[model samples]
Target: MLGERVKKLTKLMLTGLTMALCVVAFSPTVKAEAAMLQESEPNDNPAQANQLPLNTWVKGKMDDEYDYDVDWYQFTIPKRGVSQIEMIPDSTNTSGAGWEVSVQDVNRHEMLQISGRTAESYKLGLAPGKYYMKVSGIHQTFVDNTHPYNLRINYSESEEWEIEQYYENKNFSNANNILPNKKYTGNMYSERDVDYYRVKINGKQ
Candidate 1:
C-alpha cells in the first residue's frame, strides 16, 4: 500500500509541473502576436496612421546650405501620403500676389507645374517613388522688402510628412555638387512667365 501511494504522488507532481511550464512559455507568444496585428492594421485616416515609428524627414526655412529647420516659417508633410499642400506667406503676404508649386521625376525632368489652389497637392495613387517639390512666389506688385515665405507639403503613404526648404546651395556641396540627390533648382517666379523650381532630391533614388 505504501509503495502504491508514493508512485501516485510522484506522477501527480510531474503532471502539475509540466502544465505550469506550458502556460508560461505560451503566454509571451500570444501577447507578441496580438501587438503585431495591431500595428499591421490600416487606419482609415492617413494622417493618424502615419504616426507610428518616426522616420527621418526634412523641413524649415532655407538657411545657409545644408542646415534644415524643424518649425516656424515652416510646413509639415509626410514623405509617404501627401494629398494636400498649404502655403503660408510671410508677414508680407507674398502668396497674396501669387504662388506656384511643382513636382519633378528622378531625372530632374519637369513632370508637372501646379498653379492656383486646386493643384497645390496631388494624389498619385501609386507606390513610393523618387520625387522633389518646387515652390515659387509670384507677386504682381513688387515688394521691395525680402519676406520669408514658408511652404508646407502634406503627403500620405504610411505617414503624413512635410518638406519645407531644402537648400542645396554651396557650403555643403562636394566639388561644387550640392548633395547630388537633395539639390533643387528654381528661379523667382514671374507673373507672365512660368516659374522654374526643383525639389531637392528629398528622397532616395
Candidate 2:
C-alpha cells in the first residue's frame, strides 16, 4: 500500500511541475500581445512620432475604420549625407489598396511624398538632424487595418569633390579620369552638353 501511495504522489508532483513550466513559457506571449495593442493607438502627429532606429525595419498598420489615420516615425541623421527611406506594403495587399508615405522636416514642412503599393526608396541629401515620416492610407474608405507595412531608413556619408565643366577631356576616349569612391559635383553648361567620366579598377572590387 505504501509503494502505491508513493507512486501516485510522484506522478502528481511531476504533473504540477509541468503545468507550472507551461505557464511560465506562455506568460511572455500574453504580455507581448498587450504591448502591441497599446502601441497601436494615438500615433498620428509629429509630436507623437514613434522613435525609430536607423537601418531597422518597423511594422505598422492603418485602420480602415478610422477616417483619418496616420503613423508617424522619427529618426535622426548622424551626419550630413544621402539618406534612403523605404516604404513597402504587405505583399498580400499590394494589389488591393495603396498608401502614401511622406517625409517632413522637424517643423512639419513637407519634403517629399510617394504613393503606391509597391516598394519605393527615396534618396535625398539631408542635414544632420531629426526628420519625421508619415504613412497614411491613400483613400479613407479603402484602408485595410488587417494589413501591415514596413519602413526603413539608411544613411551614407557624402564625399565632397568638384568637377569643372569644359575640361579638355570631354569625350569617352578622353574621359576625365576619376578616383574610385569619390563624389563629384558638376553642372551642364547647356542643354546640348555631355560629360564623360572613367575610373580604372585595379582588381576585382
Candidate 3:
C-alpha cells in the first residue's frame, strides 16, 4: 500500500510540474521598447553628425539660435533594410518655420525630406551603407528653436527576405547589381507601386 501511495505521489508531482511549465511556456510577454538617445553637439554636418541607432528616439535641440544650430545624425545598415523615420515636433507652436528634416546619402544627396507639423514620417528603402539624418536650423527663413523636436528611427532588417515581385517591374533605369548566393529584398510600397531590377554581366562573349 505504501509503495502504491509513493508511486501516485511521484506521478502527481510530475503532473503538477508539467502543468506549471505549460503555464510559463504559454505566458504572454511584452517586448521592450528601444532606449531614448540625446542628440550631441557639433553635429551640424554629416561629417560631424552623431551616431543614430536603428531603433531609438533621439531628442534634439537648437542650443544656439544665433549660430543657426544644425543637428545631424548618421546611421549605417549592415544589410538591405527599410528605415522608418518619425519627426515629432512640438504641436503647440506659433512659429511659421518648424524644421526641415531629411535622410541623405554619404555624398550628401537627399534621399527623402519631410517638413510639416506634428509627427512627420517617411519610409526609406536603402541598401547596406551609411545614411544621414539632418535636423538643421539652416533654413531660408528662421527655424523654431523655442520648441524642441523628437526623432525616432526604426529599421526593418530583410537580409534573408526575398524581394517579392508582386507588381511588375516596368522601369529598369536604376539597374541593381545582385550578388550570387545572397538574398535581396526591396519594397514595392503598395499594390499600385512598381519595382525595378537588372542583372549585368561583364563576361567576354
Candidate 4:
C-alpha cells in the first residue's frame, strides 16, 4: 500500500509541474532572442514588405533586374527604445557606392540613412510606431541574385538617459511632467525637433 501511495503522489507532482510550466510558457513576458530569419518574396514594396522581428537576422536578395529594385521590411516595438540596423552584402563591392540603407517611417519618410556596401546605424528616440527598413543598390550594374545580403535589427525598451524619444512635450502647453530628483533624456531627429518639460516643487527650506 505504501508503494502504491508513493507512485500516486509522484504522478500528481509531475502533473502539477507540467501545468505550471505550461502557464509560464504561454506567459506574455517572453522576449525575442537573436535568431536567423529568411525574407519572403513579394517584399519589394512597403505594402508587401516582410514583417521583421526584433534582434533577428533576415537574409534577403535585391533585384538584379533593375537598380531601383528595393527590399522593404517592416518592424515595430512595444515602446520607445534604441535600435540599430545592420546590413551586410555577400559580394566584393566593399565601397560605399554600391548600396544604401534607409530607415523610414510609416509614410516612407526617411529618418536616418547609411550608404555603403555594408553598414549599420545606432541611435535613440526612435518613436514607437511602424517603421520600414529599405535596402537597394545605389548605382551598380553588376548586381543580381548572386549578391545576397543579411540584415538585422534590434531595440531596447528603455528611454535614453537624458533624452526623450517619443517627445510629446515639445511645447510649453504640451510640456512633459518631470520629477525633481530624476534625470531625463532628449533627442532631436531633425532641426525642427525640440523638447520641453515641466516640474513642480513643494516645501521650501
Highest lDDT scorer: 4
Candidate 4: stretches off by over 4 Å: 1-35, 91-97, 141-145, 161-177
lDDT of 2 by residue, 83-141 (tens): 66777765555435567888777767555567776556556655567888998877743
For residue 84, what is the lDDT in candidate 1? Answer: 42
lDDT of 2: 0.67
Note the Cα lDDT for every prediction shown.
0.38, 0.67, 0.67, 0.71
Which 10-residue window of candidate 2 scores lowest in summed lDDT? 32-41
Q: What TM-score number comes out for model 1? A: 0.33
Q: Poorest 10 consecutive residues of model 1 by lDDT?
A: 65-74
Candidate 1, residues 1-205: lDDT per residue as tens digits?
9999999999999999999999987886655422211122222222222222222222212222222211211123335343444444445344233446555434444444555422454433211455445544444422433334444445445322222222232122221223444533332222332322323466577
lDDT of 2 at 178: 71
Estimate the TM-score of every prediction. 0.33, 0.56, 0.58, 0.68
Error in Å for residue 190 of model 4? 2.6
Please identify model 3 stretches exceeding 4 Å from their true place: 1-35, 90-97, 138-145, 159-174, 177-195, 199-205
Ranking by lDDT: 4, 3, 2, 1
lDDT of 2 at 58: 77
